[model samples]
Target chain A: MPDDSLSRMSLIEISGAIARREVSSMEVVRNNLEQLEEQGESLNCVARLFPEEALADAELADQELSSGNSRGPLHGVPLTHKDMFYRKGKISACGSKICEKYLPSVTATALLKLDQAGALDIGRLNMVEFAYGLTGHNEITGDVQNPLSLNHIPGGSSSGPAAAVGAFLSYGSLGSDTGGSIRFPASCCGLVGIKPTYGRVSRFGAMPLSFSLDHIGPLTRTVTDCALLTQIISGADTNDPTSLNHKKTDYLENIDSGINGIKIGIPATYFDEKVHPEVLREINKSRDVFRSLGANIVEIDLPDNFEVCNSMANIITASEGSSAHAKWLKEKPEDYGSQTRERLMSGLFFSSVDYLDALKLRNVILQEFLQDVFSKVDILHAPVVPIPVPTLAESDIQSNPGFIEYLMLLGHCTRPFDYLGLPAITVPAGQTDNGLPTGFQLVTPPLEEALLFQAARAYEKENSWFFPVLNDN
Target chain B: MSNQWSDFIERNIDVPEVKSALKSAKNHSDIKQNYICLVPFEAEPSGFSKVISTWKLKQEQTEDQNA
Candidate 1:
């Protein structure tokens, strides 16, 4: 196979090819490392490149596969993760200057799982400083450029993962989403991003930005690839107390099964208003595609408390984030970036009562969403961002005060899921007028990732939505 | 009326943009007035597996298969 073909093959395809000896593992890993060095510099997506380590690992993988010993399903597939996931005896900067030299003695459970599954670790991707900001601007490590257009932000916190995967620099990438980190970037760069139900995946080695809202998941080119990656990383871990205790089940069991009679809900009110006309039109087109696939699209009425839910989510995030950084905020305040420092400091002003009140209201609002929304529909469809992918200057909330509103507006549809701890996935629907990609989000009940994948697969197949390959412009 | 909130922001947070963002997030939500609902004894906080018992996607799928 050609290097370009091998570089862009799905994890499923790569795994099959390696198992059949059609393409050696070394070929796959070497192609990605070369692409990472050549293209990653200009994209500003690579935080650190590990060419020698990766090549040696790939040679080992090729030997193991040739010896008739398959490590796991993802055998010989090359993958990368956000800079925050710790690999033992290595530095995990967490995209901050204070942690520039901070090395963790323990490897994250997700990394261990992927390693056991025979995934080749490429290099750490860049991210927002401490995964706080939604837009892909990292003042310390530099911005992660959009694979589609260098001018726009590659929706952030997981900026590197989205850009790398979108540009075919890696087969798949893991990203952490506190707010809209994963989904926003996936939408911006046209990829499949899944924020698994809170606790569905373990956060053992991943750094916490907001203890209550932080989630770890994958960004891939296709829905089935997302399912495979999620299956590998999810399950209970003792290191993460918040990890859910559940039996392991195959996430890709019915992934290819079409959503023949699935009930997909479209919100009547909260998702429609204030949305850019082009974005809304594309989302409606996705709904039409689902309808044509023999699925029923119903207009579901959500509660009038979205603003309250968003506010409560912000309160909890600020409080928990502030608590997480209390030590560094007090000791090494000067080491922090101005944007992250300011955001963390804002948490100090919120009272414990405010935090607790928001926590309690979280139950009320969740019950409301469950009873009023999820009870009637299997999945709720909404827009990831109300507008098309914005330029770096347009979504720059730090310098532009007007863009501050975009912060809430960008996360308007996604933050509620984080607050509710539900599963949500973003599928690339189509591109906008300016040629940037647009994504439609489908949210499912907790632990129903299988249904989400099945529905998204149906959409992808019906629309024939192939992942767009980024060219050398 | 304004005690340590103003004092803390003035002393610790120096950036005008940071101060403004913080104040906006703090003052805008009004959680105390609107969202603070009295909890019933049977209900747990949302973060504490509040509605997991009611949502059984897996169970329902199994039942449908058996049927």
Candidate 2:
């Protein structure tokens, strides 16, 4: 591939080229690191670059490829992860002031697995402080800007990963989704992000926001890339007690099978309500595209208590988040960002009874979702963020009076999946009237990530809406 | 926010949004609905293992059918 085309290739494409010896791993890694250095500051995406370590690793990968020693599918592929994942003996600041100097003694299982597969990690990407905020604001580090329009906010806590992938700075990024971190940023940046079924991917070394809700997954430019990364990173690990024990298999095997008869559910309630006209228009067109591909779209009413149950997710998130940061909140609250501080402090007010009750209610809500919603549809299609992507100024919670309400509404569509521990994928459905990206989310029951990938791949194949060229207007 | 809650919150952290966020949590229909309800005294806190196991089995069965 040419130099210009090299930067835009997907992970699968790059991996295949490396396998066939078309491009040396050293060439791919050096080009990506150069691009990261060139465009990274403009996007506010990179937290730290691993130039020396990455170059050495890339040279080794090239030598191994030359010697007929391919490590795996991702041989020599250079990628970045949200800064929250720990790499032993290195600082994993987690985009927070309190942990600015905190270093972990052990690496994340996902990172180890990626290394084992011959993937080179060239840098750490930026994220919201403690992965707390939904918007891409980080008072400790600078905010991550949208790659499409630098003025707009990159929907976050996975903001850096999204921006890096959007600008082709890295092949993909590993991100943690507690509420909408992975899905939201993917939607905002027009990338493919999968928040796999909780526990499907072990959360061994990723920083936690909410114990019950945090999910580790990938943000890539294509559904096949998402599948490939998921295949590499998923499975049970004893280190994470909550990790699900399931048979490991190749996720890419049936990803291209298509969703000819897949029953896609369109929520008749909250998903469509209060949505921006352009977002709604794009989602409706996406639905038609699914129809054209021979899939069935069913108008289904989610459980009446769905929205109410969904609200409880915030309670769980707050209480658990506060607990995680309790020591810090007690000692050096002044060190934290105002939004993160306030949200975590609010958890201190909720009684133990409140947390336990929310947990029980979560069980009831999951049951209702599985029986009432999943029973009728193979997948649920909805907007990841209800409104059009907001600009940084518009989403500033401190200045905007309606910020909390806007935040809640933006999270409304994606929160329920997190609450139920289900698998959901966000794909760029279309652009808004202003040319900013908007995405439609496809959700399925737990452990049905294969189905989600199939549907997303079908959509991506028919409509090439992955990364729209940046309009610098 | 209630005086007791406000007093408790202010004792440790004195942010303005603390009171407001607590007030919103109190008023949030979902939180309030769950907070006011009563679970059975003998009902155990569900670990979600069953839900996950059932879903996993179904997924396996689906894959088997496809294969």
Candidate 3:
């Protein structure tokens, strides 16, 4: 295969090429590394590159594939991970200066599972400091530039992962979502991201921002790739007490089952309120395609406290993050970015009562929301962000005084699901008038990722929703 | 004047020293009243669910017409 072809191939396409022995894994890895060198500097997505280790793994995978010992779809796939996931002997700075040299002795369960499935890890991607902020600016790691527009923020926490995938430097990547970390960047970068049910994917060895709400999932070029990645990493792990015991289901098998008769809920109030006109138009267009797909569309209203979920997320994340970094904050206060340090320090102001109140309120809010929305529809659909991808300078923490408010607005649509522990996927819907990408989210009940994938794929097929830019290579 | 309550107050609000002083005040009710005001109460539940269900049914019917 041509070097450019291998470098630009999707994970699904790469698997087929490898399966047919048309290309060696080493060839693919080398192409990816070459692409990284050529295109990566502009994107600034990769924090570290492990070309030697990655090539070695690719050679081993090529040998296994030739010997009829293929490890499945991810086998020989070159991928990277968000910096928050620990990789033994590698720095997991989490885009923070405090742990710049820290390396965990163990690897994240998601990484281990992907490795076992034969995916080659090439590097660690940049992210928001300590995964606390959402606009993807990190003082310690420098800002990750969006591949599509150098000036626009990549939508972050999973900023580097999304940018890398969008730039085609890697086939797929693992990104954690505490409150829209995965979905925000994916939507901003015009990629697919799934934040699986809390505890559905084990969090063992992944850095924690909030133990109760953090979820690790995938960001990939296609919905099916996200489903495939989710399948390999999901299910119970003894190491993670919160991991679910639910039987793993085939996420990809039923993706094309069609959304005929599937009920899709559009929250009448939240979905329509505070939305940018362009974003709303794109969401409506996606809904039109769903209508053509024979799906039932319903307008459901979210519960009363849905808006408060962001505040709830802030209180819990701050309190827990403060506790987690209390030692670091006292000893290494100057090590953090101004915004990140301020955000972390604000946690100290949340009383224990306030933290516990937020936790209790979270349950109440989730229960009320599920009761109101889930009972009426199979899945909920909404615009992932109120506005299109903002310019990087617009989201700069230092320059933008209202950055926190704007970030909260972007997270507004997503954080509620995180608090509810539901499965949600963001798929490319269409583009704005200015030509930047826009996406809509599909959300399902906790542990119901298969349904979410099915709904997403159904909509994906009904419209030419996949970004043409992804094929620009 | 310093106590467990004082530490909790100091960490949560900016007035650590003042709050410590206030903790020893004979008229503690006024401070308690001020603190309670900051707590957010649940808003009156909106009947959004009912509106949503009706809207959903209407949307489905509309899609059916377009199909």
- The prediction achieving the highest DockQ against the true structure is 1
Give the lDDT of residue A130 in candidate 2.
Answer: 91
User: What is the lDDT for A223 in model 1?
Assistant: 85
Q: Once model 2 is optimally superposed onto the true structure by TM-score, how far is the C-alpha of residue A410 displaced, in angstroms?
A: 1.5
lDDT of 1 by residue, A1-473 (tens): 23788887777888888888898888888788888888999899988877788889888888988889999988887788899999987788988898998789888899999998988887899999999888899778888899889999899889999999989887899999888889989999999999998888999889988878889999999888899899999999998888887676688888778888888999988778968999988999999999999888899999876657666777888789988998888789888877787777768778777887777777777777887887798899999977898898867667455444567788887888888888999999888899898899999887889899889887886764556332211
Provide the lowest-lDDT 10-residue window in model 2 chain A: A464-473
Across B1-67, the per-residue lDDT of candidate 2 in tens digits comes to 3644466565735445665666656755445564345444554445576777686698569889999
**lDDT of candidates 1 onward, in order:** 0.83, 0.84, 0.78
Clashing pairs for model 2 are: none
Candidates ranked by lDDT, best first?
2, 1, 3
Better of 1 and 3 by TM-score: 1
User: TM-score for every candidate vs. truth?
Assistant: 0.94, 0.94, 0.87
lDDT by residue for model 3 (A1-473), tens? 23666756778888778878888888888888887777777887877889899998999998998789988667888888888889999888888878788899998888889888878888888888889878888888889988888888888899999899988787889999999999989988889999998778999999999887899999988877788899999988999987877778899888879989989998878657888999999989899889888889988877755766667777678778888988887787778787776666656655676666666555556556667877788899988877877887766755234545656677888887787677899998888876778898998766678999888877666664554322211
Q: Lowest lDDT 10-mer window, candidate 3 chain A? A: A464-473
Task: For candidate 1, give the docking quality class from DockQ.
Answer: acceptable
Each candidate's clash count: 0, 0, 6
